[model samples]
Target chain A: MRTILILIKKEFLQVFRNPLLMSILIVAPMVQFMIFPFCADYEIKVLDIAFIDHDGSRITQDIIHSFDASDIFVSHGIIQNKKDAEKMIQHDKIDILVEFPNQFEEDLMNGEATRIAITANAINTTKAGIGVGYTQEIIGGYMQKFQEDNMFIASEEQIPARLNLSYIYWYNEQMNYKNLIVPGILVILVTLIGCYVTALNLVREKEIGTIEQVNVTPIRRWQFLIGKMIPFWILGMVEFIMGLFIMKLVFGITVQGSIPMLLGITAIYLLVMLGLGFFISSVSENQLQAMFIVLFLFIIFVLLSGLFTPTEGMPQWAHYTNYLNPMSFYMEVIKKVVLKGSAFVSVQTETIVLSVMAVIVNTGAILSYQEKSK
Target chain B: MAALTIQKVNKVYNKTVHALQDITFEIQEGELFGLVGPDGAGKSTLFNILTTLLLPDSGDIQILGMDLINDYKQVRQEIGYLPGTFSLYPDLSVKENLDFFAVMYKSDIEANMDLIRPIWRQIEPFSKRKAGKLSGGMKQKLALCCALIHRPKILFLDEPTTGVDPVSRKEFWEILQTIRTQGITVLVSTPYMDEATLCDRIALIQNGKILGIDTPEAIIEHFKGTLYTFKSANIFSLLEALKRCPLQCNYYPYGEHCHIAFYEDMETAMPQFLQFLEDNQQEHGDIEPIRPSIEDCFIEIVKMNRHE
Candidate 1:
């Protein structure tokens, strides 16, 4: 135990002494955290829209005016014909096109249904999908108001009966993309800091031949590994807490669950990640090899971690593979606790799995480490 | 008592390169032992096995009468190893590296200060400096301090002076002598044959095999032929000329002279050798019999084994 403490002290001294590494540990994550959430946003904030208005009536003008007034669509004014609108779309000047029939206003006046064709570019599928949804909501709102004002004049038989739909978003009421993205970014920040640092530290010793000196000592393999792991674990926690502050201050995401519970699970997840780092470092002979291996696994962990997209929507094989990914479990637990104000009972299963992974990977790290090679 | 005993140790890397073959030797307590060989003669491999950092494919090694393989945990507490390379953390300060290794052994510098005092005193002035920034000699001294911090029963130094300046190399060997005087058995490996003479006893090794093992004087005494050294204005031309001469001898360029060991009777062979050199028009100086150093014996032994 004394030996382990000394080793930990030595590791911390080395980490603090290297200014480049210190800055990378502290600064890179903060910069990435500040930049990534806004860049990775899935919300379609702008849809460049153009219209072919065959009917130059006030009703068509009002519908076009509504699209212009909204925050999401960038209205390109009215075009004379479909050919010119198609030409604009081909030129990449417009992402969406709205076409109205010559009888569109006349049909609505006679209490008959008419169609407004919405042609959305499918190149960027998500933007196109969400833009279509926004368009329908705007047109629907305009029609509802139109019906209420004109309902008293229309005969009861001509008026069509409709089933009204309403929605209430439960957890994220405003559907703020930042709230989801910020927590996911926090998970990545904590993971990269923990795993990348730990992985590089040991491999560096091997590269410089320092590990051979340490290996000859009386220190137990696990003791040395734990000592190597502890300082980085603390660093990872520090980065995580910093990310939490940024989440609240910049993104306005306050954790609704118990703070201690969040930290408790974060500690376990760090163990799993650090163990993975140790495992990689032990198997690798040099820093470059370890780096590539860590990068490959990190890519898989982050992409499949359900941070950017919902795991529920993934294919059957991908969902099954996420079970092997520690980041996925941590991502789920963090989102639940932060977004839903979930208590310990709700996150119990994920916590248990993370704890089990912590044991397995750490044991694998200790076992794979050869203090005496064959 | 035997501080370390190895009976028939063998190591084959990748089933092809025989790194150490049938290696067997022993060191008594407080004795300074040397494993002398050239760069690729498997000295580092032997050191790794002795330090519990590697496992020999087949061998029985006992250190202080305890099994080196099975009792490695206890064995580690009793041995200090300075590998061929400078293995201390370069980013760490001299003092920090010392304290870190001391703590690793669960020992304290203050408690074992006397053991490392001789080497530590020289590096203490540079204690604040990072090890990587230190000169080669100072880096070695700091490494020595770290290795001796635990005060192990035996110490392993593999080529400690390989890259050090000549003055520092002498100082390093002197330090080894001082260390030996403190009753710590030392096993040092070096490629310089002159350094081999400094050890109490050395095992001459080559091509993963032990060429000879005994006191330096005894190995010299065992030299088999009449060795002669003679200067030549053109040593390379003399060597080419000698290759054509009909004589039973082993010859090699030694510094500015050619050293040849002849197995035939010298009285008859000497006159004939001079005539042969004259006939070949080889320019040479007076040839005189001289004593063989450890290097001569090593070359002779390697050559003899090759002939067999």
Candidate 2:
């Protein structure tokens, strides 16, 4: 334990002493939190739209006014002809186009239904779906309103039908992206700091030729590993705390769950990361190779963690792939605790999974270390 | 008592590269034993096994009368290790690196300060400075201080002076000598042949095998052939001429002279060799018999081993 503490001290010193690393630890989480939420949103609004109306009817004009009043579409202009509207759509100046048939209101008054045409850019499939749905609803609502005013339809005695989603974001209530992201970012930061740092720890000794000195010593494998891991673990915690503070103050993200529980989960996750780092160091022959392998694995794990996209929406195979991703489990727990005020009982299964991962990785690392005296 | 003992050790890496094969040697208490070999000669691999950083594929290693595998914890507590390359935390202050190692062995820096006092005194002023900012010699000294901070019964230094300047290397050796006097057993490895003379005894290793192990004087005494140094205006041509001569047993370029060894008696071979050069109009320079050094003995042993 003492040796571990010393190792932890050394790891912290390594992280804090390097100005470049310190800056990265502080700035990366904050900047990523600020930019990603605003840019990569799923909610669709404010689509540019153009129209070609040949009907020359009051009802068609009223339909146009209703579209302008709705917040979903930003009307660009009334194009003079269908050719102008088509040109605008082709040039990508507008995302949607609406056209009305000639004499549409006269036909409607004569008890014949008027026809309308709508076209949308399908490149961004999600955006197109939402935009089209919103436009249809607005037009339908306007027609219903006109019918009611003309007494052509009887008023409902009961409340009208509406979609009451009652969305309960499991972890974060306010849907603050930082609250959702900060914990996962903390996990990633700790993993990056722990794995890369510990991976290079032994390999650097080999590179400098000092590994021979240590190899001849009476130091046990566990002792050296513990010594190397502790410092990085402590540094991982420090970075975690810093990230937590940034989430609360800068992004106004609250820690709804127990702080100690959050920290305990983080500590376990760091052990797994550090263990992985040690395993990489044990196998690598040099610092460059060790660092490269760590980065490659880090990218793979982060992408598969399901932090950016919903895991449920992914394909069955992809969802199972996330099961192997330690980051995915931790992200889920962190999101739950910080946003949903979950207790240990609530995230007990995830906690146990992370603990097991930590043990397996560390065991593999220790077993792989070969100490032959030359 | 042997401070370290390796018996019939064999280390095969990944079931392919045989790093160390049937290696057996021992360092008595307080002895400065050197593992002398070129790069890839299994010096570092041998060091790793002894340090318990690596386990051999087959063999028994004992340090301080304790088995390496069984008594690793106690072994680690009693040995000081300085690897071939600088391995201290580069981003850490010189003092912090020392303190970290001291704490690892469950010893305090203040308690062990006297042990590393000599080397630490030199690096004391820069204690607050990051180790990476230190010069090569300074880093070497800091590494030594960290290794010694635990006050181990034995010290392992693997090529400690490989890249340092000549003066630093000399000073570093002097420090090692002083440490040995304090009743600490030192096992050092170096490829530099000249450094062999400074060791109490050295095991010359090559291609994963020990060529010879003995004191410098004993090894040189066993150099069997009469050695001669031949130099001329055209040195390369002289080497070729000597190689073709029937009297020559072995010939290799050493500095500006061609070192030629003969199987025959020196009295019978020398006069004829001079006369042959005279007859060929190639006797314009110098040719004389000389005493063999450890390096010459090493070459002779390596040559004999290769021929066998």
State which candidate has the highest TM-score: 1
- Where does model 2 exceed 4 Å of error? A80-84, A149-306, A318-326, A334-374, B108-115, B278-284
What docking grade does candidate 1 earn? high
Share of native interface contacts recovered by each model: 0.95, 0.64
CAPRI grade, predicted model 2: acceptable
How do the residues A231-289 of candidate 1 rate in per-residue lDDT, one tens digit apiece? 99999999999989988888888999999999999999999999999999999998899
TM-score of chain B of 1: 0.99
Candidate 1 has which clashing residue pairs, if any? none
Candidate 1 Cα outliers beyond 4 Å, as residue runs? A80-84, A102-115, A140-155, A162-164
lDDT of every model, 2 decimals: 0.91, 0.81
Model 1: lDDT equals 0.91
Relative to the true structure, candidate 2 reaches a TM of 0.86
Chain A TM-score values, per prediction: 0.94, 0.86
Residue-level lDDT for A129 in candidate 2: 85
Q: RMSD to the native, candidate 2? A: 4.1
